[model samples]
Target: MNDALGEPQSVLVLGGSSEIALATVNALPRRRLRRIVLAARPSAARDLAVTTLTAEGISGVTAVDFDARSTESHSVFINEIFDAGDIDIVLLAFGVLGDQEAAEADPALAVEIATTNYTGAVSIGLHVARRLRMQGHGSLVVYSSVAGDRARRSNFIYGSTKAGLDAFAQGLGDALHGTGAHVLVVRPGMVRTKMSAGMPEAPMTTDANVVADIVVKSLRRGKETVYAPGPLRFVMAGLKSMPRSVFRKLPR
Candidate 1:
């Protein structure tokens, strides 16, 4: 449940170790948050997240085992969490940005990306939606990307997965409308994080904290869709409207 100020009191982050997700948690009103659950695969990173939040004086921070690719376990995982109490916010932030050339060379690698990014999201997203609907008040913040707006040749496989995720999230938001549950789809541009480490910076590339700030603001404003740095919306619009031939010739 949210506090009197309309701030979330409990947050469940699906990708516990995600830099952007952790940043969003840090940016929230700590005094209002009672419980913070970091759900990710058991790892040192997961442990570090708990310690980091604890160091920030977030009292009820804890980590739970969660594997995005384990679709069959999602329902049970979600139910167990909700059984403890109501969740005020659920952040679906797990994903993989595989090497484009490697994915192109290995079909198996491409399938892995699709399964983790798209299929797994669908699996857990539905479960989370059901719980939110049952609670009658909450928000689901989905981390989409501008790449989904229009698939480019350089990263079409990853872009395609985000495309499916963005659409699914939109439709889910519609379904949850009037049920007192809302969804915020965050489409961040190139964000500098461990995931994008060593990659060449692209135009409008920003930091995870920048994306986190945008997400927090969007949640406060009850926005359904938002672009980090706020300018990429227009950029993506132009790219989306460009002709395929022209788009194909553009630099990666």
Candidate 2:
């Protein structure tokens, strides 16, 4: 359950090892958080995440086995977590930015991206939503991307997946309206993380911690949607309004 101030005292992060997710955990009121569940596939990174959070003075930090790509098991996986205790927040943060060129060349690769980013998310997202609504309170923060605002030629495959995810998250938010269960869709531009370390830095690029701050603040303000750096909201709006003919030629 949340604290007296309505700050979440418990959290469930789908991608336990995600830098941004971990950053959000750190950004929250550490003293108020009593239970922190990090769900991700078994890995050394996941283990390190648990150890790191614990060392950071966050109590009740633990990791559970969770495979986002394994959609069939999501229902059982999610229910088991909720059965143990009520969750105050669920962060749907699992995703892969597949090699665009490789994915386009190999259909198998593209399918993998779609399956993980879209199908897997939909499967787990709905189950999480059900539990949130049933419990009658909690926040679902979906880490969507600015790339989803409009598909660019360079990484349309990844962008398209985010597009689908963004739409699903928005609709889910609407359905959960007035139920005390809400959703916050986060659309971040290029962020400095292991995921984007090698990629060219985009305009208004920020870091994982910055995005984390935005997530926490948005949740507090009851914002349905937000941009990480805030300015990207206007940037995305302009690009969204621009004709595709001219938009396509712009640098990705």
Candidate 3:
């Protein structure tokens, strides 16, 4: 599974500390990857991520501070990466799960969710896409969710954020349709990741490893969209068709 440059040596993950993102990277051929750039906010948690990747045999690991709110600096951040060389792949995995209640109380909170989940990602990703296109190839994997299919009252704020991200990724995919660069939009059902640790688990909940495996397979196959656990595609279809009144009543 060596890439053209001797191996899939260089990789970039925007939310390098994300559990799902980390799982996906681990699932990749470690022997083929020489370096992994993990961009995340500085915190004790991110420091632990560096140690974990190092323990997993990912030797060339670098952590850079990236604030999703600072969309203006996204270009500079990406330029720094390309200044080195063509990155094998870039995963836009950064996002925040805002408290639904808080968002409802304060519109600013909702705006924050939208900015972090959608605007910030798209800003940086579009830049990366252009770089990949110019270089003639690379993979961009964006994390969307089934909740984006239809906004549910239980989690409409979060759902809406995903909806925007899903749409942005799709449009980006189309815009780069003929370019050698490609985009993969991943929709996974509820998972027990740290993001949703306190929430009750949902049906067909998958592990981070499962999501990672699907992403890898999707990239290999050049799939435009992938649903984790696979069956979620149909599940979401049925859920989306359900009456809103009924949908809202269903226990999450």
Give per-model TM-scores. Answer: 0.98, 0.97, 0.94
Cα distance off (Å), candidate 3, residue 184: 0.4
- Order by TM-score, highest first: 1, 2, 3
Candidate achieving higher TM-score, 2 or 3: 2
Candidate 1, lDDT over the whole model: 0.92
lDDT, model 1, position 52: 80
State the lDDT of candidate 3 residue by residue for 28-138, as single tens digits: 766678778899998776788789888877778889998888989988999998777778778899988889998999999999998999888879888899888888878
Clashing pairs in 1: none
Q: How many backbone clashes does candidate 1 have?
A: 0
Candidate 1 lDDT by residue in tens digits, 159-178 = 99999999999999999988
Cα RMSD (angstroms) for every candidate in the order listed? 0.9, 1.0, 1.9
For each candidate in the order shown, give its overall lDDT on alpha carbons.
Answer: 0.92, 0.92, 0.86
